[model samples]
Target chain A: MAILDPTTAPRRSQLNQRHVSSHALFKELGSNLVVSHYGDNDSIIEEHSQAQTLAICDLSTLPRIGFKGAGAPSWVEAQKLNLPAMANTTVLQGSGSLVAKLSDQEILVLSDIFAQSKDVFHLSEQAKIYHKNYDKQVYSLPRDDSHCWLAVSGTLASEMFSKICGVDLRTHKFSHSHIAQTSVAKTNAVVIRNDLGSTPVFYVLSDISGVEFLWDCLLDAMQEYGGYAVGVSALQRLTKEH
Target chain B: MKLLTCPLNGKRNISEFTYGGEYHAMPDHLTSSPRDWAEHVFFHDNVAGIVTEWWCHTASSFWFLAERNTITDEVIRTFKADEIYQQRVEFTAVASETQS
Candidate 1:
């Protein structure tokens, strides 16, 4: 098989430069390119273990979309998406997509790691096809171009987040599928708790323009806990365990 | 860092908030004089005691009303703007022309 170059992929992460400098092996997920792992082929298992301890993975290239405004809730429901009962909560759909209710009138949809879920893609396509048919008050927010998504996982993830974020993200305080919209390292971001299997994972989304700064800040905060970056494969492996 | 509770987003570091200004009831644009418009838009009471003010959660962009003691720097309470603004107020061109 020919090795795929991330630079030539249809979509790439904003931290592509950082991954390239770290000797990252790239793989294609859907049409997007993401880091498969770092180091030699034999190190993938080691990376998976490292992920259980502490690791950050870039999922910025994944499919994610948002809708907001007065009619957003009913409009999303009409599309067969189940929303969380309250604001700042999330619901994992049977279709493998996750819907996060940011507020009564806003919801963000994210695709599963394997890229098997077509909910995000479908929502976007539906909007494009039925722009006039949908509720006028329900507007689409294409987060792929506006926000950069990163996943911080493992046992020490919360401890690392405390260094920069104001929210109390300790497992007990912030459970799975809970959302926090606050400042992290002085940059505004949305932190959502979405565990992968038994591993505690928090997805952080921030302005794409300031992603490099936020990435550096997160890395610096995690350094004291001996945390480092892993690749998507490590995360994919974690989900298979327990 | 000081903490402030947002009506919608809960408590957060003060740095995450932007002080919009004192919350003032809008003047009747069609009948109010130019001086009223100037005072409403460009000036502030800067009250020394407890007063209602506007604050926005920078992260969520959620704006709410806060009653605080300016002297003690203590926030008395926070509430959603909807509590006071029950209906949408639109200014028509006629109102704009009257103000002009």
Candidate 2:
């Protein structure tokens, strides 16, 4: 296949320059371009192995949206989306997206790793539709532009996090449903655990402007464990039958 | 590293919070003089004893009240802003009246 240009996408990741520098191969994911694989690196099989041990992937271009305000919880529940009983916990919608409550009023929704789920888009549309009814007080927060999403996966992923984060994120300490809103590498980030089948995967959402620094920081810390960047294709394999 | 407990997010590294100045009862917006407003916005008591102050959790932007001793720099307790600010305070611009 011919090398695709990320620049062609209307929406692009903030780390596009860094990815381009690292020989990243572009692929379309939900109207945005993401790194399918870093060209000149190991094949997807090798990348899959690297991911099982320690790997970082930029998911900045994936589908994600946030809602906040007094009426958000009820409004979300009205859409038939199952919500976690408490804040700082996440639950998978039977339709496939993940919903994470940041507070009593705020929640963030992310698409399935396969990028096949349209739950986020539907929620976004719902918010727009009901926005005319000011009674709901639910406000839409389009996170795709405001925040960058990155996923760190592997058996040693939690160990790698300790190097930069102040919070204890060990698998024994922080479970898959837990969320940590704290300082990481001196930058504020919302950390959510959503493992890939058996392997642990933590999703970090931070200010988009600071994403480049965070990305570089994660890559630098993971170097000691021979961690490398992988693509979505490799991550998908982790969730399926091996 | 110092640790600060956020009323909403629970305990977190002190670095995760931004001190939003001392919490003070707001003078009635329509009744207070310009000087009173200026003092309320700019001047802090800087008390040496325990005092309530405004703090924001940087990651979640959760604003809450914290009682801390200024001299010792120890936080006594943290609680949600709703404890005191139950009603919304609206500031409407009187543009039409002022246009004259």
Best by lDDT: 1
Pick the DockQ winner: 2
- Report the C-alpha displacement of residue B9, candidate 1, in angstroms: 2.0
Writing each residue's lDDT as its tens digit, candidate 1 over A117-188 gives 889988998888767676467889999999999999999999988888879999999999999999889888
Query: Each candidate's lDDT (Cα)?
Result: 0.89, 0.88
True contacts kept of 2: 0.74
Across the candidates, what are chain A's individual TM-scores?
A: 0.97, 0.96
> Whose TM-score is greatest here?
2
Cα lDDT tens digits for candidate 2, A1-242: 56778878887788888888888887777676778888754677888888899999999889999999888898888988888999999998876789999998898999988788898889988887798776646889999889999999999999988999989999999998899998778888999999887888899999999998999999999999999888887788889843
CAPRI accuracy category, model 2: medium
Error of 1 at A7 (Å): 2.1
Residue pairs with colliding backbones in model 2 are none
